[model samples]
Target chain A: MANRVAVIGIGQTHHRSKREDVSIAGLVREAAQRALDDAGCTWADIDAVVVGKAPDMFEGIMMPEHYLAAALGAVGKPMFRVHTAGSVGGSTALVAAHLVAAGLHQRVLTVAFEKQSDSDAMWALSVPQPFSAPLLAGAGGYFAPIIRAYMRRSGAPNDVGMRVAVKDRLQALKNPYAHLHLPDISMKMVEESVLLWDPLHYLESCPSSDGAAAMVLGSEQAATVAESATGRRPAWVHGMAMRSEPTMFAGRDQVNPQAGRDCAKDVYAQAGITNPRAELDCAEVYVPFSWYEPMWLENLGFAAQGEGWKLTESGATALDGGDIPWNCSGGVLSSNPIGASGMLRFLEAALQVRGMAGEHQVEGARKALGHAYGGGAQFFAMWIVGSERPN
Target chain B: MSKIPATRQGHRPVAIVGFSQNHSVRSDSTSNEVEMLLPVIHDVFDRAGLTKDEIGFICSGSTDYLIGGPFSFVTALDAIGVWPPKSESHVEMDGAWALYEAFVRLQEGDLDTALVYGFGKSSLGDLDEIFNLQLDPYTMAPLHPDLVSLAALQARAVIDQGLGTEEDFARIAARSRRDAMNNPFAQIKRDDDVATLMSEPYLVSPLRRHCLPPISDGASAIILAAGEKAFDYAEHPAWITGIDHRIETHAFGARNLAVSTSTAKAGAIAGVGEGHVDVAELLTPFAHQELIVKAALGLADSVSINPSGGPLSANPLMSGGLNRLGEAAQAILDGRATRTVAHATGGPLLQQNLVCVLEGA
Candidate 1:
């Protein structure tokens, strides 16, 4: 097995609520082409391809990987479709990494995408079948209560969420490919927005964007080849881990899921770090909802229990002066393609580690963490990357 | 037992350490995916003899459109019964791909054991037309090219190539349905013959009801243990020593409809090179597809095929692939065979293929 694998290239599309102009295949191809160009390679350079999306119903396609295989430049090769709920983006990357980590393939192209515009997600997610009572209307409706619980338990002020929304929107201005560019977005705009899911204002949530994200992942040899072609140092993978528990069982804490914590601890342990807040230079954590920033801050053990909201309130997570800038690329709230949201975080983290984040770059970032969670926070995929090689 | 003295070269390596499957039926009247999976999920945990706490990772595969729902896996967590959570992920694919995902995770050395499963109930709506959504929505779906016609095209291609006659196909259909008489989980079992099946007529030219896999409503699970933990799970766990998957293009015009190159490549990687397959459980929805896959995998003439009736007996969409592994594992468990190879195919003309070789090592 290869001792180390790195991300040599990353590309993502402009996310939006609807992509009527392009087909699903075209949407994914846009990102894939950019990734290949960024890696300074062509389709033939890729040994395998792994694609991930939320569900078949989201687009009313029953396992559409077959149709999508050709679109992603995967004609006659190993193409895998991974669906791990909302965490599929992260899962796809981890799966690609495994191909390298297991000494199986050298350069693998991983893509995750979603076109919510193709069908009604709410209708697709909530199909009243023969048995069981309907939960909330859709995913947001289902998770709203959990967000409310976090607020009540932690006594977080409502303005904390508003502030997060404003900060992320401002940051999105720097990212050309972000879907939501609320140039005029501010705390006042968020505060005045209608509460769709109690405390979750319309402005506080991620838009259902039609987009894709792709990355060229390679083993040591592949990365070396890329470095010569692209004239860039690839982000060195330091440590990675994935964990999962049941969705909802007895004594389940949706507010602070154990799976997220276990995933964080495992990756940190592998990276040989005791204090996450002190050890990492920057992090691109999944934050679809503004409140998730603080919620995940606590779950990842970056802040003391019940003190995550304080980090957000104190402005310690800003890209300019904060100790650990979370989502310097604006995160899910600013640009979301449901299936690719997790990969965006991972890609952004790689961008920071490779010293190529442009205007949003965290200065002198030597090490970074990419984190994502999905399916009511039951799944987690985390990776630590650094400029220096692991011993 | 036939004293073949199983040579290691003839036996591929892969095993069923953990197995879980939900109840099978035409339709599941459930609120969410979580509820449907809750019950039988324990079987995999129990059969693998590992607690949820011990599982290093979790990978699942399922189609969202199966139940007319999107992000089905997102809500399926209600059944996973996770609280305080665990490290887990999902794949938008068949359980076979989920197994592939779990396999990759195992190689990461983060965890040696993983839980992988896939579920789908093709009863929620017009599954055949719904599958049209899998095509290029703008170009192919508007044309409403049903899945049956596509398979019929492949079958017709085979006929054009003189691969097999329609009579041969009818015999395969009759044999599979007849074999289903023994499988309790088979939904389309009938005491009928090829003559009756042929007389009934065609849903599409060169294809009949018997020639098609029933719109099965089912779920399946498999536990994957890496290295040493695999042995501790079961007395003779189906250790996955050789497993690989590959894909072809989706464009109908571009692909050769008569054979499965992906399966050939995957089988070669899975060490099908010199092995004498004892029981080959093939997931071929169409009879002609069975022949195509058989030729692709290069199975010997004497090898027993579809011992558990196969997909023609009862094809259950997403779970069908895992069901093939289960059937192969059951054979090993019964001591009827020491080695077997199970195969699964997805998409039109078998665009994707997964090969799992198992033995009582």
Candidate 2:
């Protein structure tokens, strides 16, 4: 059996379009330092460090973790780097947690970041390769058709994406670290925004920001000691999983990826959850674009097939009155550092379970789900956290 | 200060059941990464007498800069055709680290088998210019110091400290080339005398052209099985006894270039000195680096080092590290050795290192 692990510390930078105040190393250290403080530990307490990012092109550096090792206090310690596209953040944390769960380390610090301001992410992502057809322009161009397919298949209302865009921006007002705080966000504003890709308005897309997220995962013994000293309960890791499929195939379902569903099922099963909608109090899912909220709702099995948009229309995913609130921290639609976006989702879920999410806290949240996907929705990483330890 | 854990107690045992590699070449211009990996993946599965469906998980290691395109690993997945999807993850480091991740996942006791692979085509771009990106962006990278010059600095340190001489490097290079003659997959094989090697022009001061590893394009794959599954896959399994990795400060000025503290720490944690090592494979891309790593590992003089010519014969960037591990495991699997140690280095001038100890049951 695997050893028990828990999240004892969590920290993130105030995401923004550009964090010109600090260098890449400095930006990562700020979050790592905050996490160290939260866990009531020093640099000496960490057994290893795991770093993650989307792509090296975002910063014009190949494997930037090697350069930031000293800045992150990884000297004379095990330092590992992970890259799994956008889902890299969640996979990075999962790798760190496994160290503790495998009885290899007592405490591990995992971090993910993206300094998109250093270069044009869209251009970097759109770089043409040899012998491959340049059918897509950028991520938006590739995913736009998928959203259109979902609309045709589900027959959802045209205003659904606009509603999600407004709702998430409204929630960002409550999150101090959120990049975009649109106080006057409304459906009219989203509807009037430019259509960057057909069927997807500019307001419905995720913003490119420079940011990072970090968490300190500890074994059961370390968590107990931290709790006794700080009087703060740790968010127990009930279960975690990752799944991947080929980016392209003839019969692949781009709208509702099987990888996401299988990953959710595996994690939920390990958490002993039979009904995710009833068991999970809230969710922090990777909704890079507004439409992904409903798409993932069904993919995660929180709603029946083709009925996910109805759940959104029924106010079931809102933090104000929803039973199973999602994206209480504004989610990727509000701020996306690409690589760090998935980790923010995972971190927010832990925050909700620990009752540490001050303004965006879901009341009486005892269990929550965190979800992230990348690379044409072929890679999926998800985890379930709870206030109480698993049996 | 808390001491690092010396050993992982009661963890599940995992072994390298199968391994395969493509012949190292200056350039594989015709085939992309996926195309290069397809045959190697099939060969590894065949070597283990298993099918793709039997693998519980898959992991890979590669960098985008080699191909100058983002999500290179994503496209490489086409080789496996993951129809129902599989538990998987990836690392940006060398394939040895990917194998480490797979080893850890097996400790969860849910997965029985995993496939790990790494590939890189250094000829696709100017590695000298591209490698500078690994330095500190705010300071070292701005200087545009190439990899060869940085390695030369370490070589200079080794010589200045009297750890070794130019003749020692020449002998090691000559021995590697002589050994490569028996290995068909080696990129550079020549039976040259040490005196002849010493006459070659210096690629950089104190570092002759023979001292550097040949830039090659290659792919390698290894299949790992846990506990009883290891025996079912390979008749003589190379059981992984211990594996550990550590990183040093990125600032060269802050470190002792003549010694590899990170390698020593990892070797100690991996229990390299626990038993007699019959053979060892060190990923010393630069000839003098072998001296530092061999000393750090504390291997006896009787231990055969780089019997397959090591990276001096062929260095394929991300894949080279895993190749060392695979070579060490092959020694045990082929009944040529009972126990072995493998070492892999990453970053500039051995800033990070990984050590794995394997033994036949």
Candidate 3:
């Protein structure tokens, strides 16, 4: 039988536009140290390390893991690097989980981060290709047109995107680690903000952040030790799935990507989730842009294709009233560290199940979903975690 | 006071079913990354007697710095036409690590067949400057030490330690190139005398031009199947008995440059000494490092090393490691060897190492 795995420890650096206080190694070490402290384990206890990040160009490094081996306490141990664009963090976590699940390692430390302050992401992302049209503007310029297509296809009201922008920020006020603390955030403020990507406003976009996220995943036996040591339950992993498609193809639906749908379906099947909307206590879905909240709601099978926006319109996805609250920790809209953003979702989900989310805790949450998508929405990774171990 | 004793868990048997690669080129300006991968992917799939959909998972390895573009692997997915979406992953390291990821994923028993591939166009950027960025940014990268200079430091340490000399480096390079004559895909093939090669101008002190691997543009692919399905694909599957990788400290000065502790550790865990090794394919970027790896792996004079010429004949950044595994498996399939060990190294000066032991029943 395969070994059962659990998220024994979770930690994150205080997300900000620029972490000038630390170097890349220092930034990751902060998160790794915190996670190790949480798990009551030293670096020597870890059997292996798996690190993930976006493009090496973002930090002007080739394979940063090599240089970081000593700082990460990965010397004389196995260290692997995962890269799948924005989904890298989620993928990295899943890989670490597999190391435990497969009984290859007793305890694994996984870290994901992006120090955007080290270099310009927009410039790095827009490097022209040989036989393709150049991406002149940043991610917004490319995603704005897709947002327009969603609005036209679903006949969504213009304010749906604005509402998500406001709701996520309001939740951010309660999250101390969140980069943005918009106490006065409102639809009016989002509407009045400059339209950087036509359909999306400046306030609606995710901020560029320099931060790192780390998790200590262990085999079931290690989890027992961790629980006894910390007096906290481990977040038992239920199921995980990853899917990918080509970046471009004729008639490909960019609005609700099939890859995202398939990934959620596979993971849901593994976790025995029939109706995600009613089953999952909460969700930490990647919503870099506010409008993605509803779009992903539909793509992830939370609601019908056109009904996704209606859920947001009913204020049902908000932290105060909604049963199936999404991104209660303000999500990517609050803190976007590119590579670390997805793992932040995974960490936040684990926090919810462990009853350690503090201010953003979903009351009595038993299970939660963590989701992320990357590239031209061609890559998707998702996992379900429960307070109780799965049979 | 109870704990689960540390044990190697979930040993799901898997085998390399198919392997393929394109001819290593110094610069093939006509084809882009995807175009270069299309034929190799098809060749491997066809060789394995499986279709694209038959693959339960797809994992790739490549770096953006090699191509000077982010998400290069994204467009490369087009070569497979993933309309219905496929389980996939990518690593920023060599393809061998991608193989390692897939190997771990297969152990879950939920997936059986996986396609692993890696490609890089080293001709695109100033590789020396780019590789320097892999160093510790705060301390080492600022110095801009080129790869040759770093390898020279390792070579100098080897000579100083009395483990090997400049002539030994020349002999390894000469033998590697001579062996490349049998490898149609190898980039550099020559049969020259070690003494004559030693007389050539040194690119870096104690390192002649032949001591370094060619900066080649290439792609490599392998198809892996688990358990019974492994025998279904190949008559003599290269059964992966053991595979393990380990890394050492990045502070090269703190490491014993004459020896590779990581490779030795990986080899020990991979059971390299448990069986009589018939053939070995080691990924050594510099010639002197070959001697270091051989000693680390504990290969005796009976072992046939680099029958496929190895990385010294043609080193593609991301694909070089996978190519070594492929070459070793090919040796097993070709009736040349029944048991083989393959090694891959990453980071500056063999800081990280992966070892895989394959055998035939």
- At residue B160, give the lDDT of candidate 2: 94
Over B24-95, each residue of candidate 1 has an lDDT whose tens digit, in order, gives 566665524555676668777777777777876677777766666555666565566655465666666677
Q: True contacts preserved, each candidate? A: 0.79, 0.88, 0.85
RMSD to the true structure for each prediction, in A, is 3.2, 2.8, 3.0
lDDT by residue (tens digit), candidate 2, B80-137 = 8888898989999899999999999999888899999999988899998899988999
What TM-score results for chain B when candidate 2 is compared with the true chain B?
0.97
Stretches of candidate 1 above 4 Å error?
Answer: A122-130, A135-137, B1-14, B18-39, B45-48, B74-80, B190-192
Over 4 Å off, model 3: B1-10
TM-score of 2: 0.98
For this target, which candidate reaches the highest DockQ against the unseen true structure?
A: 2
lDDT of 2 by residue, A172-239 (tens): 99999999999988999988999999889999999999999999999999999889888899999999
lDDT of 2 at A297: 93
lDDT of each: 0.79, 0.92, 0.91
* lDDT of predicted model 1: 0.79
Of the two candidates 2 and 3, the one with more favorable DockQ, higher being better, is 2
For candidate 2, the per-residue lDDT at A295 reads 94
Backbone clashes in model 3, listed as residue pairs = none
